[model samples]
Target: MKTTITPRVRTLVLLFLAVVGMLFAGAGTASAHAALTGSDPSSGVVVNKAPTQVSLTFSEKVATNNDSLRVLDPKGKRVDVGKPSNISGTTYATQIRSGLPDGTYTVAWQVVSADSHPVGGAFTFSIGSPSKTTVSAAAEQDVGGGLVGGLYGFGRYMSYAGFIVMVGGAAFVLACWQRGAGVRALQRLVVSGWVSLTAATLWLLLLRGSYTTSGKFGDIFDLNLLGQVLQTKTGASLVSRLLLLAAAALFIAVLFGAYDKREDEEKRDLTFGLAIGGGVVAAGLAASWALSEHASTGLQPGIAMPVDVVHLLAVAAWLGGLTALLVSLYRAPADNPVGRATVQRFSRLAFGSVVALVATGIYQSWRQLGSWSAFTDTGYGQLLLVKIGLVALLVGIASISRRWTGRLADSDTDTAKAETVVEETAAAEEHEPEKEHVTASAKTGGSSAASGDPKRAAQLARQQVAVDTTRQKRLRDADPNLFGLRRSVLAEAAVAVVVLAVTTALTTTEPGRTEEDAKAAKASSSSSSSSSSGALTLDMSFDTGGKDGKGIIRVDIDPARVGGNEMHVYVQRPNGRAFDVPEVKVAFTLAAKKIGPLPVTPDRITTGHWAANGIQIPMAGDWKISVTVRTSDIDQTTVDKNAQIG
Candidate 1:
């Protein structure tokens, strides 16, 4: 005996494998929705004096709570003193304790992007000099803690899957196959969709707080955390979804119970009402996402939100309906096989959904990308390209399904005509006289007329058996058109699963426009900082042979140009505090011109500060600036840098 896999089992296997593959592919890296642009004292930069506050600038606006920002000193102690705030457009700041000890400190921040996704990261900056940080390496993990990120991603995927299934399944029953409501398989599909969405919404709401702030697993269950989540836009949208689901439940109940039981004529009247009511509920559900996610916060949000809702509804109707159709084909009762008209109607619906998807997708792509280069430059854009390719493949398969649908429709029409002709002839024969029946007995091959003669009746019995065998053979062989359509639809559905997964991943990725804007903002901030200081400063780290020789050297050349200039040098130990060294030396040479190696002797102004006035540079060119430091009589090292003197 051999075991064979059925179409239904194959479909399940495909879906399971696709889901597992998607999860495994993305497990190693989960991108953040908001990107950090710049930070004050900048990561790895050292300041002479401790600043009163630490500020960060992001690519987009972000929501903050009390614990959104934190600072840890060299000793891994909390040093921040106030709540983080939006001090300016896209810039947030938090005050730190005054007179912080000179050492490298870590800034850890987590906040909700305008799109309602949580993003967090950590970077280190020094007060007086770079130090060996004591903060745990985990502080720099930018994604929501690994487990939390994975769970959140799973919830997001489920929400999308649920919306498509529920909305699409209901739409198919209402628009394509009114009788589908009575199909148990379809009924389960729609109900499972609702349950999945409801559960996912609850999960996201519970986890939002922890995901945005601490990334701690234990924080997800803290009841107090719910309060904070509810205050945010994402929370509000989730609550709205639950309310809408209540309305959806009523819709589902009416569709499968009362509507299924109604007479065909009665259903016609109720369908108009149900369609209107269901459409509104579906749009509302779509709006719940549009109001909180990427569409609500991006450029032209007023337009984008409505477009996004349309996009989502189109996806549900197309992909979700494909799933429903596939199930009905494979699992509908043999007595009530899926009709050709139903498939044709869905073909029309899917076409319309595709039109809407394309229109809305173009607008969304423009809104998020802002430029052509972003298509290849950003993760969000790259993922979108992958989705586009998958959708194209799905559409190609749908075309094959449409052709098969057309053939099935034609076959059904011919079969119906032949059946009608057979019925009319049978009725005519029943009304004919006995003489007419006897006259036509040879051609009609009727058992009744031949029963009068033993030989004729025996001959008729054999002929009847042969005719019945032929009819059974035809019935045993499935319709080729229907089989082809089912196969094409299956392929479409399989591709749809992968497309949906990519779509879920897109939601968490930072848009290309946002990433570009962040880079621009960082450049502008750096330029402003450099202009304000009015000095060409070079910072370098050095280590001598001595036990405590690791430290940073800051060389500042005021109005660094050809001819006369003033130079200042400061040294600090790894703990970031100013420290004295055995000796320090500085010199410069214009390597391009083979100029002299000019030596500048600087007198010590303080323990770690030294200065040289009226230092001369003979020409403006790339000059090699070398600094040598001696920590002990035998422990000395030299470092070099090339700088423009003009």
Candidate 2:
């Protein structure tokens, strides 16, 4: 028989599908927390002599090896010597070959962040003088994108979805409604959860290697790559999850098979055992995430990891349980409807889950945010706000469901009293004497039926139909309240789906506290480097009104004060590679003091560099500095800026 779905159910189904679509739509946009704070022989600078080693500093500790850092020459060839070394927890250095050529070079790095996410980037530095480079920054830093990243992110969401559903559904059956163990619909739901989790876990295991490096789809199935993945922390977590799922399979069997057939006391004993075992398995599954994700590496990891586990379990119990309850309400057989007691029991469990959620959520927010400003300042904090809002909406819908449950309970109690009264009156009437006319009719009918009387059979059928009609009417009277409760629960489940999706994204985002910390570290390092160097550097861009005339000019001055100073200039093409320019001129003027535009003649020292020695600044004041460059004989442009000679 074909069954029609209610309008509410149809809407909820559509909303859930939309949420799932959104999950995959933006899943590959995960962020990393280990930011590059500083690097030696920094980007776009010219050094007269190439340094023996290139060093990098990060805001947080990261895991790196020889392959993590690569130094490539202007021609895109590896130039680094021996293995790269981790100079410190937050610093890494690599030795480069001696007597390197005078040209630009690229340094590309990829490392596992403190939060266990892979991040990579590239930069360029010049030796002696900048030169045209064939290396492209975009091509060198393709560490986290393409098909592999998308698939890995999809696997992550699926794993979370499966674990929540399986754990929550089993908890509902074992704790709130044991009779649900025998329901085929609940059985299928929990089994689907197991299947999803197992499949996603395997998919993740296969993709982890490629997802962390190169982000190539072809490398996903490479056994060597897979073995490399097995040695990492995330790999260990995935393995643990699979082992726990094995135990989960046994738990599901006991719940539906042996427990369903047990007597009352035996059922109770089995339920107690299942609850304990399930709790262990669920916590273990949650730990697999807690020990590998953001919680394990950030501030106060000892407390954060355990709290994260609580948060995951609480979420599963509340959101997952809602799915199981929703299925039971709409799909249970007419003869075995979800009872008022079952609804009340789940209501209590949901309340406790919400309490745990709030407590753990508060601690996590404090840990990740570290301050109030992050709520408005950072992406992680903003997403956290969205989740909190959705959770509140879910709770509101849940309260409405509770009210409907209370109403259903009251209506059922009244129905029970009415049924009892009807039964007692029927019992009293059983003892009453029958009329002589009725007694004669019955005796005649009995005789006709024994002789094969169709008329008597028809009369008996009509009497039985009258009894069935009264019972159906009684059931119809109670359905309005049941339907109301179902609608509210459906709303709760719909909102919970959005909450879960936001949560998945939140876990992948860089926390606000870490972002702020990185920014502070970068600023401090920049300030220290500037003070120690005691040199003024300025960059300007010029378009010389010719084909390919636009380029950047970097001007450097030592002790740029009211005295003689050496000035050097470097020019780079629009592509950021250094190139030679024809006919360059520089002049300075103290316009406020009406000083002459004193010219400092520059002579070519290298292919893309020029030097002017002992240029004098007559006074300590704002001076207009003008630079002119001619790409061709007729094509030239002059750029001007003010400099403070202190």
Candidate 3:
């Protein structure tokens, strides 16, 4: 005889099949955003002579065109001879024209990272000496500001949400609860997931083009920009995601279509094939995201990438199945046997998914944050910690749901027992009259009791029926643990949404390892500072008026003891208020070495502040500095001060 399958045993089988399917399906490479690792003539460095070229090195290979790198002189003019060229795979270099004058020059660079995300920044370097030029390079603006960034993050969250709902919901319907196959709400959820992912991917592509090029909202639909974006890795990944979504939709339709009309045995074979196909598509879609995110560009990507795919699948399964289970609870009756079975099966599946999620999460954390301090020091690490905390909270809520599930099982058993007793009592009542009449005769005298027995038997039969009705009613009214379970599951799903949002933000953030490396580099450079690169600040007073004419002149020289120095002059009136002069110039003279009158014209910054760049201090000596302030072009006064240069 063929053995009948029990609900509990079937649940276990389905869980096993789901886990196996995910493991086999999630095997693909991952990618991440790039970071700058090092640069020649580091920011704020004082060099004895100007270098012929400027080079910027990144942690990954970069893609660039003509406008990728720019070098600006103290006067804010482009000094780079030509377009930047990629050197040795990772470095981008731009040549400087010969006869470049000594002064502070700013390098502004922008390039597409290996993952096809554009990254740019600006830094300054001094040649011969730092100048008081007020024309500093403009800082790169954040793409589209907070609103755009938030929209991008929202798109990512929606994509994640949709993936979980569609994939996990389909898996739940096929593997765990076939009854849900026809549920309109569950089917809608799957469709909604597909739509969300597709729409979000398209939206992100447009946003990314604008983001990378710093274009305005009007440029979002520009064909040239769109084509350029499509050529990039990120764009290709997004396109692949859409293709996978289409394939998934067809496969889901086939699976459901087969189930809607097939016999039980046929459904088994069809669902098995669907599972295999769906798993492949799911993994491919996940890989598309990983190929353009932090996992791909991060440390040990060979290991981290596949791990991320597993992590994503696990999350989708647990959270997505939770949503399906909640829907089942809402639509099905409180004592619905199918609903109870679904809850139980999903609970088991979720437990396994949580285990996978935790394991993969720990590994990813280790890969992203190599040291303990990074957890406290880096934004990425801190955000990860927040996500972990939320996951733990979700687990706690799930535990409550599990407890309620156990109670539901007990409730089901009691209800079943009561139902069985009702059936047996009803069957025995069919022959009750004869048995009752005989017992009545035995209790009294035979013929006298039989004459009145008919009326009494009818009355007793009515009373018996009343008692049975009451018993059945009480049993039916007992609670089935549905309300509590529904509430808990809802809470769990809410927190899961929050976790997804945080995860989306995490992908955009810089990894802790990169941040730590940058810090270490900064520290090393600062430690190598010497007297030639020392900074100094000085104060002097100029008598511009006859009697009470006392204007304070404050000079700030960065790397004051070196070949190149930046001079910032601040003038204040006799009443300690800022003094605005039309033209403020500084003339330097080295008397001991017989160097005389190196007049420097500084750009006027604001009313009381003046800056001069490329103030070349030829050698180490005592230099006399004269500050000339032209109050009205006619009314001018000079102040003298001495500075020791090394």
TM-score of each: 0.72, 0.72, 0.66
- Greater-lDDT candidate between 2 and 3: 2
Clash totals for all candidate models: 0, 0, 22
| Candidate 1 residue-wise lDDT, 334-411, digit = tens | 445677889989999999999999999999998888767788988888989999999999999998898888887553
Query: How far is 611's C-alpha from truth in model 3 (Å)?
Result: 43
Q: Write the per-residue lDDT of candidate 2 for residues 1-646, one digit (tens) a residue.
A: 1123467667876886687677666555457677776677666667779899898877567877567888899888888887778886566999999999899999988888867788887888899888988884553555555677767776777899899999999999987888888888899999999999999999999988888887888888999878877888888999999999999999999889989999878897777788889999999999999998889875678999999999999989988899999889866653455778889999999999999999999999988887788898888999999999999999999989998898775436645744664565445435544423333445466676778986975675555454444443344334577778877887888888788878887877888866765554344334321312657666655656455565666677787878898889887763446768877889889888999698877998997798898998888876777888888889988766555666
Model 2 TM-score, 2 decimals: 0.72
Best by lDDT: 1
| Global lDDT of each candidate | 0.79, 0.79, 0.71
Alpha carbon lDDT at 607, candidate 3: 82
Name the regions of candidate 2 deviating beyond 4 angstroms: 1-3, 6-14, 27-29, 410-478, 521-646
Q: Which residue pairs in candidate 2 have backbone atoms (N, alpha carbon, C) closer than 3 angstroms, thus clashing? A: none
Model 3: CA > 4 A from native:
1-34, 47-50, 115-117, 132-137, 143-146, 332-338, 409-480, 526-528, 532-646
Query: What's the lDDT of the predicted structure labeled candidate 3?
Result: 0.71
- Residue-wise C-alpha lDDT for candidate 3, range 196-251, written one tens digit per residue: 88899898888776666654667678888889889988889998998898898897
